[model samples]
Target: MIKIETPLTIDKVKCLKAGDEVLITGTMYTLRDAGHMRVIEQINKDEKLPFDMKNSIIYYVGPSPAKLGAVIGSAGPTTSYRMDEFTPALLELGLKGMIGKGARNKEVIQSMVKNTAVYFGAVGGAAALLASCIKSSEIIAYEDLGPEALRKLYVEDFPVIVVIDSLGKNIYEIEKEKYKIVE
Candidate 1:
């Protein structure tokens, strides 16, 4: 497995390839659908964002409330497609990477290529394991959204796979082709 850290620069993003396992260590933002919408709204209104987008990675998760003594709970990745419509705009604004589960749409892939970004896939069934990697979590914005509120997370060795590389190589498409049944 490859080891990577954030804030991810174009150099770091370009070095990754689809299908490579990675253990990421550093800061990442957590936001679900409602938080994404709120961010877009802020951008449209020309308001400053709560965090810097440049060279940053956002994780798509709405973690469950922590049971006393835990940093976060059940922090599994959410389906990425739900955020596809908002992704290109964020990519345009220098967002460099995203961690989630499932395939993204064509437009999202195209945007990643255009902006030199990457998409990582976190295992879906390993919520507790993922939460263990989070060293700290602080709500950053949209607190009214509760679990969907934006959070800044400090992580260490958070596991993921490069689902889509900056050059547009996609593991989902590659794997499908690799195992396709001959007609």
Candidate 2:
């Protein structure tokens, strides 16, 4: 498995390819649809964001309440396409990587290619296992949104796969072709 860290640089992003297993380390943010909407609204208003966007990774998640003595709980990836409408704008703002499940839309893929970014796929049913990778977590913004609040996470060796690479090569497409039954 390839090991990577944030904030991801352009060179690092470009070097990755679809279908590569990766263990991501360092910092990332957690945000679901509500958080995403708030961020885009702030951008539209020309207000400063709570966190820096450059080279940053955002995981599409709304973590469960922590269990006793745990940093986070059941932090599974949410379906990514829910945030697709706001993705391109975030990519344009220099967001380098995203972590979630499933395919992105055409516009988001185009934006990723243009912005030198990547998309990671986290296993959907592996929430508890994924939470163990998170070393620390803190609510950074939108606390009123509760579980949907934006969070700053310090992770170590968090597991993911390069579902879509910077060049727009998609693991979903490749795997579909590879496993397709001949008619």
Candidate 2, 32-114: lDDT as tens digits: 99999999999999999999999999999999999899899899999999999999999999999999999899999999999
Once fitted onto the true fold, the runs of candidate 1 whose alpha carbons sit more than 4 angstroms away are none
TM-score of 1: 0.97
The sequence of per-residue lDDT tens digits that candidate 1 reaches over residues 1-183 is 999988899999999999999999999999889999999999999999999999999999999999999899899999999999999999999999999999899999999999999999999979999999999999989999999999999999999999999999989988999899999
RMSD of each: 0.9, 0.8
Weakest 10 consecutive residues, lDDT, candidate 1? 66-75
Off by over 4 Å in 2: none
- Candidate 1, residue 40: the lDDT equals 96
Every model's TM-score: 0.97, 0.98
